[model samples]
Target: MAENKTQATGASVDEFLAAVEDSVRHRDGLRLLALMREITGKEPEMWGPTIVGFGRYHYKYESGREGDAAAVGFSPRKASLSLYGLMYGPEAAELLPRLGKHKTGAGCLYVNRLEDVDQAVLAELIKAGYRHVTTALHSP
Candidate 1:
C-alpha cells in the first residue's frame, strides 16, 4: 500500500503554529494546542506540515491496510479550522449540537472561527473522538 502522506513528523509544533500567517488562526491554534493537550494528556506534535495532533492510535482494516494515526488533531487552515476524528466517534452527533456553528464532513469538523463555537463543547468532542478510537482498539 502507498504510504500515508500525513505521517507524524518530528517537526516543532510551536514553530509550525508560529508560522501560521493568519493571526486569528494562529491564536486559535495555540488555544487548541492547550485544550487538546489537556484533554488527551499528551503533548502536541506535528502531523505532516500542518496538523497539530495529540496522541496516536494504530488502525487495521479487513483488507490488511494498517497505519497509525493521531487520536485527535486539528489544522488551522486558511479558510477554517479543520478538526479531525470528531465524526469518527458515535458521540459526535450528540456533542455536535452543542458545538455551535460548524460544518461536518465524514471525519472532519470545520469551523470558520473559534469564537463561533463553544470551546467547552469542542473540548468534549475531541475527548469523545479520542475515547472512541482508543476504546474500539481495545474491544473485541
Candidate 2:
C-alpha cells in the first residue's frame, strides 16, 4: 500500500542499511546479516523499504499472479523484527520451542531482540524456510 515510499532502497547494501536508521534495530540487522550469510552464503538485498532479503524465488498464484520474491528475508520494524519465513509449514513447527521468545504471523516471525532468541534456532528456522520454499518451487 503506502510502503513503497519508505526510502529503504538504494544501489548498495550499505546505503540500504543506512536508511534503516534505528540504532538497536541496526545491530539486530547486522546480526541477521551475519547469520543469513553464514547459512545461505548470499549477500542481503533490500526487497522493499524495510525488508532485507537473501536469495530469491518465483511463484505463480492460482489466481494467475506471478512474481519474484526473496526465498528468505527479515525486516527490523519499530516494535519488533519481522522475519520473512514464507510460511513456517510442517517442519518449522518443531523449531518454535527452541526459537526462544517470538510471535508468528502468516509468513513472518516477530522478535524483539536477537539475544532474546536462540541464534542456532533462528538459523535452523531460516534454513527450514529456504528448504520449504525451494521444495515448493520444484513441485508439480
Candidate 3:
C-alpha cells in the first residue's frame, strides 16, 4: 500500500459543500448534496479539497505510522460522485448486488446520481464500513 500522504484535516464542512455547489454548475449535484446529508447525519468535511468526508477514523499501520481519515466519505467529481467506503475487498462483493446500480473500486463507489441507487442501502453500506474500520482499529 502507498503512504497516505494526502491526509485530510482542518476544513469546514459547510464551506466545503458551498464551494462544491458553486463548482458543480449543474442541477444533478444538488440531489447529490441532499443524499449526502440524508445518509450521513454529520455534515461533510473538506478532505484535500476534493473529498467531502462524513465521519472520521484514526488508523495505525504496522510501520507505526498513524493518521486520521474520514471513516466514510465521498467526492463530487465532474463525471460521477465518488462515494468512499465499503470496499469490494471480498467483504463488499456480496453486498454490491443488493446495493443497486453503481461501480465499486478499491474503496470508492462511483455513481452518476442519487436517483439511480437505494439511499437506504447506501446507509447500510456506510454503517458497515464504519463498524468494520472501527473494529479493526480497536482490535488487539
Candidate 4:
C-alpha cells in the first residue's frame, strides 16, 4: 500500500502562517490557527508542508491500509482555505447550508475568506466533525 504522504512534521506552524504572501490569507490563517487551537484544545502541528493539523486519529481500512491523520485541519491555499474533516458526519449535511458562502470538494470545505462565512457555524462544524472523527470514525 502507498504510504500517506502528508505526515506530521516538526515545522513551526506560526512560521508557516507568517510566510503566506497574501495579506487576507495570512490573516485568515492566523485566525484559523487560533480558532482551531481553541476548538480542539490541541497544539497545532505542520502536516507535511502546508496543512496545520490539530489532534490526530489512526485508521485501518478493510483492505489493510492504515495510517494516522489529523482529526481536523486546514490549509490556507492560494485559491482558498481548504478545511479538512469538517465535512464528515450527519451534522455536516445539516450545518453546511447555514455556513454562508463556501464550496466543497471531496473531503474538504473551501472558503475564500473567513469573512465569507459565519464563524459560529464554522466553529460548530469543526466541533462536530472533530467529535465524529475522534469518537465515531477513528480512535484518537
Candidate 5:
C-alpha cells in the first residue's frame, strides 16, 4: 500500500501562518486557528506542509489501507481556504446550505473569504465534523 504522504509534522504553526504572503489569508488563517482551537480544544499541528490540523484520528479501510489523519483541518491556499473533514456526514449535508457562499470538492469545503460565510454555521460544521471523525470514524 502507498503510505499517506500528508503525515503530521513538527513544523511551527505560528511561523507558517506568519509566512502566509497574502494579508487576507494570513488574517483568516489566524482566525481559523483560534476557531478550530476553541472548537476542538486541541492545539493546532501542521499536517505535512500546509494544513493546520486539530486533533487526530486513525482510519482503516476494508481494502486494508490504513492511516492516521487530522480529525479536522484547513489550508489557507492562495485561491481559497481548503477546509477538510467539514463536509462529511449528515450534519454537514444539513448545514452546508446555510453556510453562506462556499464550494465543495471531494471531502473539502472551500471558502474564498471569511466574510463570505456565516461563521456560526462554519463553527457548527467544524464541531460536527470533529465529533464524527473522532468518535465515529476513528479506529480503536
Candidate 6:
C-alpha cells in the first residue's frame, strides 16, 4: 500500500504561516490557527507542508491500508482556504447553506476569504467536525 504522503511533520507551524506570500492568506492562516486550537484543545501541528492540523485519529481501511489523519485542520491556499474535517460533520448539509459563498469536496470546504462566510456558522461547523472525527472511535 502506498503510504500517506501528508503525514504529520515536526516543521514549525509558525514558520510555515509566516512564509505565506499573500498577506490576506497569512492573516487568515493566523486566524484559523488560533480558532482550531481553541476548538480542538490541541496545539497546531504541520501536516505535510501546508496543512495546519489539530488533534489526530487513526484509521484502517478494509483493504488493510491504515494511517493517521488530522481530526481537524485547514490550509490557506492561494485560490482559497481549504477546511478539512468539516465534511465529516453531520451538520454539513444545513451549515453549508449558511456558510455564505464556498465550495465543498469529498472532505474539504473551500472559502475565498474569512469575510465571505459567517464566522459563527463556521465555528459551529468546525466544532461539529472535530467532535465527530475525534469521537468516532468510541461510537459503536
TM-score of each: 0.94, 0.84, 0.72, 0.97, 0.97, 0.95
**C-alpha lDDT of residue 87 in model 4:** 88
* All models, RMSD in angstroms: 1.9, 3.8, 3.8, 0.9, 1.0, 1.9
Regarding lDDT, does 2 or 6 come out ahead? 6
Task: Give the per-residue lDDT of model 1 (tens digit) for 1-140.
Answer: 97878888999998999999999999999898988899989898889999998888888889888888888999999999999987777888888998999998867899999999998888889888989887876422
Please give me the total number of clashing residue pairs in predicted model 1.
0
- Whole-model lDDT for model 1 versus the true structure? 0.88
Worst 10 residues of 4 by lDDT: 131-140
Off by over 4 Å in 5: none
lDDT of 5 by residue, 1-140 (tens): 89999999989999999999999999999999999999999999999999999999999889999999999999999999999989775699899999999999888999999999999999999999999988888633
Residue-level lDDT of model 4, residues 85-118, one tens digit each, is 9988679999999999999999999999999999
Off by over 4 Å in 4: none
Candidate 4 matches the true fold with a TM-score of: 0.97
Compared with the true structure, what per-residue lDDT tens digits does model 2 show for residues 70-125? 77888888899889863454668788877889988776889998899988878888
So what's the TM-score on candidate 1? 0.94
How far is 118's C-alpha from truth in model 2 (Å)? 0.9
Off by over 4 Å in 6: 138-140
Task: Name the candidate, 1 or 5, with the larger lDDT value.
Answer: 5
Candidate achieving higher TM-score, 3 or 6: 6
Clash number by candidate, in order: 0, 0, 0, 0, 0, 0
Worst 10 residues of 3 by lDDT: 21-30
